[model samples]
Target: MRIGFIGAGRMGAPMVRRLVGAGHEVRALGRSGDARRRVTELGADPVSFTAAVGTEAAAVVVCVFTDDQVRAVCLDTPLLASMPGGSVLIVHTTGSPRTAEDLATQAATRDIRVVDAPVSGGPPDIDAGTLTLFVGGTEDAVTRARPVLECYGGPVLPVGPVGSGQRVKLVNNALFAAQLGLITEAVRLATRLGIDEATLLSALQHASGASRAAATVAAKGSVTAFNASVGEFIRKDVAAVRALAAELGATMGTLDSAISAQFPDTERKS
Candidate 1:
């Protein structure tokens, strides 16, 4: 398969490597010399955005940051215009559900298929081909993109129509953010009771209250340490969730309290 890829950063680079290793002809959009070198090192043929999508391809995978970047690459550029009729555009970015729906509508005019295929896990998961994809598209679109998605995804779930994937991903991230708050507070409460941080985390793992978020906090040695590493990213996702909730006139339910406690400033800003 001839594949066009965008965003060769931490997550994107490994996915490109997996595609290249899977015997696909992977051409990546490289805007800078360093970006080109990085993708090349991963066995991709790095090219400009125009060249990447200009040629006929079986699929194009986008793994950029932010909703704006996804729109810029797919809508503001020549991507949708240059892609062939039957090719599928798989978006791996976690962003607005509306972005996917809007792009799908636009791309449909050109006979191109669009799949909102936001992924979970990190670079290591991509390298190991264990990343999970929350896919949203027509049956035909999902079927067409499945084989290529399987190159790096373990479970490619077709949740529903065009924007459903992003909806699910947002909810997933929001829940994770809530879990971070719960786990962090629990650690604090344990400390107040004279229990050691390490000991409390270890016991929790064997208890019914054990969770992935708790494990993550434990691994980092403290909530402060974990937040220092990923708080900004989590905050970004949380903000997206809050925006979507407001747009839909929906509430966050219990997630509201968790987000408020963990990210007071962000909650207030939203």
Candidate 2:
């Protein structure tokens, strides 16, 4: 399948490489010259601009950050207007379900098929080509997308109709936030009880209570909560989940409690 990719940040860059390696015809867009070079190095054609990528590929996959960023790229890129009818657009960002649904509606009006197919697994996971993608769209659309999705992911499970992917992603992120909270407390307790952090982690990994978040915190330690790229990312993701929960008129109990512990003040200090 012919694929187009937008955003070549940490997550986006590796994903494009995987698709290219999978032997798909890939066109990619990056906001920097270095990113463009990286895409080309991966054996995929690098488009000069976001607009160029949108117009050229049969399917466009967005892997940017945030809901607003995704919206700006799609609406302002002008590639949507240039893409031919019957093209497919897939959003891979972890954002609000409403944003995905809105984009799908807009794409549909232009004779484009759109779906929310947000993904999990970190950059390392992407490189391994074992990422899990949760899809939100019609059953047919999900089935049609599986082959292309398989190029970059595993288990392309259907979450629901348009935007359901984002909804599910939100829940996933929220759970991560909560899990981090649990592990943090567990470590604090363990340390207080004369157990070392490494020892605590080794035991947890073998125990039934072990989870991905727990393992991450164990590997990263308390310091990663304040530093590291993923620390910032998780803070934003937790916030996004909280804001979405507020909009949905639901309480993000575990997630909210988790966010309070992790990033009480995440203003990105100047």
Candidate 3:
């Protein structure tokens, strides 16, 4: 399979390496010198975005950040026009569900298949070929993209058509944000109770209150430290989920309150 990839950053770099290691013919588009160097080192041929999309490939994998970036690269740049008919475009960016649906409609006229295949886990998981993929697309599109995805993915689930992957991912991130708020609040309570933060976190790890978010807070030594490190990214995800919920006429209820209480800065940004 000839795979054209974009956004060879921390997460994308490892995924490109996985595809190359799996013996795919990988060509990557990187706007930065460092990104180009990284993908080149991983055995991917460095090419411009225009060149990458223009070339015939079985799949084009996009792994950029934000809905705006995704739209800019795929729609604004009009990469879909250049992609060959019957080829698959796999978007790994966590973004609005509507983006995928809109792109699918646009791609259909060109006879290109669109797959919303947002991923979970990080660079290490990609390197280990154990990242989970929440996929949404036509059955044929998912089937066409599965082999390339399986090169770096664990369970590649086709949840529904078109935007379903983003819908599920938004819900997943919202729950995570809620859990982060709970974990931060728990840590604050432990502090006021005169209990050691570490001791409390360790106890929680062995108790029913444990969660990945709790462990992340524990590893960072405190809620403040954890928030300082990942608050912006988490906040971005929370905002996306909130916006999507509003668009769908769904209520976030306590999850919305929890996010506002825990990450007030994000609420202000919104």
Candidate 4:
């Protein structure tokens, strides 16, 4: 399939490589000089971010930093006109599902297909095609999205109709943020009680309390301590989760207060 990608950054560049390696023709653009070099350097059909990726593409992939970034490029772009009816436009960024629904409503006028298809796992998994992807759209749209999704991940499940993917992905991130706090505090308390960091991690890795993040923080403790600046990232994710919770009339009070109290402003790594 011929693919056009908007936004070339950490996640976007690697994804373009994955698609190119999977034998798809990728027309890519970057919003900055550094990003442009990285994409073209990796053998993609590269252009400036403003270059129109007008829709000869079988699929157009949108990956940007924020929800607004996703809208500015995909929803606001005139490329939707260049797209022939029935071509797929998949959103890979995570935000409110409302945007997906709104875009789908707007795109339908042109017969353009839109799907909320946020990815999970990490950058390493994206490179290895092992990320767990959640897709939500019409059953037909999910079916059409499968091939493109497989280029970067495994088990792209159709969870529900449009925006469901965003909901699920948001919850998934919220859970991780919640867990990070629990695990960190558990370890901190253990230390206060005189348990060693390495020992605590090793035991937790095999215990019922073990978590996906436990192994990561354990393996990289020294680095996580010095470089991970985890507190700041926790703030960003906590913010995303909190916004979603508010939209759903759920409370993010505990999560917010804990992070505000525990994580200092200077130490944020994401």
The best candidate by lDDT is 1
Better of 2 and 3 by TM-score: 3
Better of 1 and 4 by lDDT: 1
The digit string of per-residue lDDT tens for model 3 on 53-90 reads 54788889999888999998888885777788999999
The candidate 3 region of ten consecutive residues with least summed lDDT is 261-270
Between which residue pairs do clashes occur in model 2?
A: none
- The C-alpha TM-scores of every prediction are 0.96, 0.91, 0.95, 0.88
* Residue 262 miss distance in model 4 (angstroms): 6.2
**TM-score ranking, high to low:** 1, 3, 2, 4
In the range 130-190, model 1's lDDT, one tens digit per residue, is: 9999999999999989988999998889999999999999999989989988887887899
Best by TM-score: 1
At residue 139, what lDDT does model 1 achieve?
99
Clashing pairs in model 1, backbone N/Cα/C closer than 3 A: none
Q: What is the model-wide C-alpha lDDT for candidate 1? A: 0.88
Give the per-residue lDDT digits (tens) of candidate 2, residues 1-270. 788888767888888887877888888886678877888887888878777786756788888888899889888668688666777888888888888778878888887887898888878888887888889987766765676788768777888898888888878877877677667677778889999877888788888988777777666655355346477777777767777777777886555666556666643211
Give the lDDT of residue 44 in candidate 1.
Answer: 91
- Full ranking by lDDT: 1, 3, 2, 4
Which candidate, 1 or 3, has the higher lDDT?
1
Candidate 2: residue 256 Cα off by (Å): 1.9
Q: What local distance difference test score does each model get?
A: 0.88, 0.77, 0.86, 0.75
Q: Candidate 4 lDDT, tens digit per residue, 115-162?
A: 888887667888898888889899878777788889887978889999
